[model samples]
Target: MMFHYYAVLAIAALSCSSTRFGVVNAQIVGQFSLEFTAVFKPAGIAQKLFTELSDPETSILQGSILSTSGLIYDPNNVAIKEVAGQFAGGVQPFLNPPDISADGTIDGQCTATSVNEEEGKILAHSCFFNICAIEADDCINFYSGSPFVYAPALDQNQLPPSYPGTIIGGTGVFEGIEGSVEVITVAGREFTSQTSSSGDIAQRIFLNTNFEFLERRKI
Candidate 1:
């Protein structure tokens, strides 16, 4: 059988600087919703790491992981807007587990690109994320930077949950551009995982995101 989970999550805003544009100069907010499901499929110790239990039934450990999602999409409209990506990096407190407390965190980098095969234009970016579990059911995440950073400063460029993230740089038309997005609405569920016949038990993460483009302009 297949397992699925849906959670309502709150999203953080992002920022980027530009002499030609300002957040206040934003004249319109374009809203878009994004949803996607991901899985953890690993070999050797990884499969055991994400699927095993610690002494307290739930514990987090210090290790690194690499995971990828299937396909993400924009719903309702007949036309499809999609993207696919993955995350990989280190986790805190290996002796203890993956998601246990507010201190349990994941520091990683991600790469996502829009897949609008029909239009022949694929927009993709490379960025970093810092996610910290707040409680048993909540976690705060920060994402920042882009592919153009020359070097990836995963730790230094992180954007916090309370603040909007800025666009440092990007691919294609987003190059040298600065902008911040507003959270229209965000909601998700408790993190859950399930085992499969293939020995790969992936956690189910269902997220619904609606955000408005607060600022988008060339520098």
Candidate 2:
């Protein structure tokens, strides 16, 4: 028998920043669903099995189940094209923001630029930071010192768990003009198990299904 499963993550942009140091709000919405069908065999065994397995009464007994154990991150945010442009005399400014928001909240900001002229065209500064609350009066801040490849088409699923993947690839200040960029693909998989029984006989099974990241543009 074969089964099909699907998982989706929906993101909604709450607002856009007004300036280079402005903040934005967002949400992380996720869902999971599964469909099961029995593979047919010769001599009507498959038809009989499917008929028996698909019955309202037996469907529950044979159907595969799916659940949301937990989410990787409740909410994450990444800033793209917020601060990018050429400086005076076409001196191309090194584009780097103060921080990147993973929880959809902006805490702090950073400023960065290219080290040289030629490097400015091929590379840009990629800085990111996050805010952590300490009690009600105190809070700790974190930041990324070295810049990374700046690619807006990518998303967190494409980068390391600690940072969003949307920041990977393209010409950036992190690496110099001569620096090289590499493209990579990342995917998520869901784990599932199934159990069935007929009369006194019973069986247990386990399976793995894959989920893909769909790119969405913020309007």
Candidate 3:
């Protein structure tokens, strides 16, 4: 009975020590960025017929699978400088010793929400990306919540080159994380025509994604 009483006291002491040291309710505070080139390819396309009074053109929904074997680079790296050069209309030189930091794929789907005479079609997209971190030897899944694409005259070229996107949540090291992503289309092609029922096209974009861990809830 005496030994049992001592053990109970010891456990209580350890608990108090942990509380005093601020071991509980620790906040994760910091941010990191990821950059990679992903190629977008059509995976599926479905047309939605207009049943109500609306535009004469048929609305279509499209799904795409974006894959990448491209090397990831730190924003401060020389390889990124080269990409920036290309963005600025300078010759894009090959990145030697290509810094292989990470690679990933994204699954995305978009549908027309509305059509305008001069502004063309407005699309809403939801995309999720899974990345393999070669340096950390881990993986993170980032969900880009709804981002809008405004295409004027039904031309994807009218879409914004750089747009704001959000990382609502993630997995792995990024579990319970949230932040913003700046999507920059370094190079892209027009999406398949709305009238065409079948075909595929390829395009590339550089995703500059940033993250910060969300405040952890107390147990």
Candidate 4:
């Protein structure tokens, strides 16, 4: 099967929970400034549809859904704790290095697993683990596992000049792409600034959104 890779446009902030697959509320948080293109299954009449959708004048709406299958990782490990905290909650106040997993890779006995498909061209997967750590205040907190993208790939022409070749797997699905095509925008505040006392923030998140079209053959 020919898979057309799309770029990872934005990171959506999901609600905190102990469940495996995080929930994606229908809200845009941040904007995606990157630029690129993705082409999937370009054949015969499909080519015309692709051209129309890819056109600059055309407007594309991006959305996503959570995967069913989840992965496994070390929840008790420090690295796992940090990632769990970051994925579940943003950087903690007055906590430098705040146990945030800056790097998107799995850590501490984490493994990726694929879930059974529910519909056509739709697959479910996730990465799960836990974290237990002691704080400076002599307090102990335990964090459960969280889900993230497992298979991220870049489609042809989706990467920009600076980012050449396709990058498969990362925070976002497509490594390259341009212009807020699909993005997660914070609703009430900016990513760098805090607007609420509870530290309630927002992000424009995309989940399992894909596009495919056929290309016309020149005879």
Off-target runs (Cα >4 Å) in candidate 4 are 1-110, 115-122, 135-151, 155-219
Which 10-residue window in model 3 sums to the lowest lDDT? 1-10
Number of the top-ranking candidate, with TM-score as the measure: 3
Per-residue CA lDDT of candidate 3, range 31-87, in tens?
443343443333433333343237445333233222322333322221322232112
The worst-scoring run of ten residues by lDDT in candidate 2 lies at 197-206
- Indicate whether candidate 1 or candidate 3 has the larger TM-score: 3
RMSD of each: 19.9, 26.7, 14.6, 23.5
Candidate 1 lDDT over 1-219, as tens digits, reads 011112223463333221222111212223322222222223311212222255555322222132332211112111211222111111111111233111222233334333223332223333343222212222224343332221112231221121234433332222233334222112111112322212222121222222232433331
What is each predicted model's overall lDDT from 0 to 1?
Answer: 0.25, 0.21, 0.36, 0.20
- What are the per-model numbers of colliding residue pairs? 24, 13, 0, 38
lDDT of 2: 0.21
**In model 2, what is the error at residue 125, expressed in angstroms?**
3.3
Ranking under lDDT, best-scoring first? 3, 1, 2, 4
For candidate 4, write residues 8-86 as lDDT tens digits. Answer: 4456533221112211111222332221111111110010111134576542111222211111111211121112122
TM for every model, in the order presented, reads: 0.24, 0.20, 0.44, 0.16
Q: Rank the candidates by TM-score, best first.
A: 3, 1, 2, 4
| Native-to-model Cα distance after best TM-score fit, residue 204 in candidate 2, in Å | 37
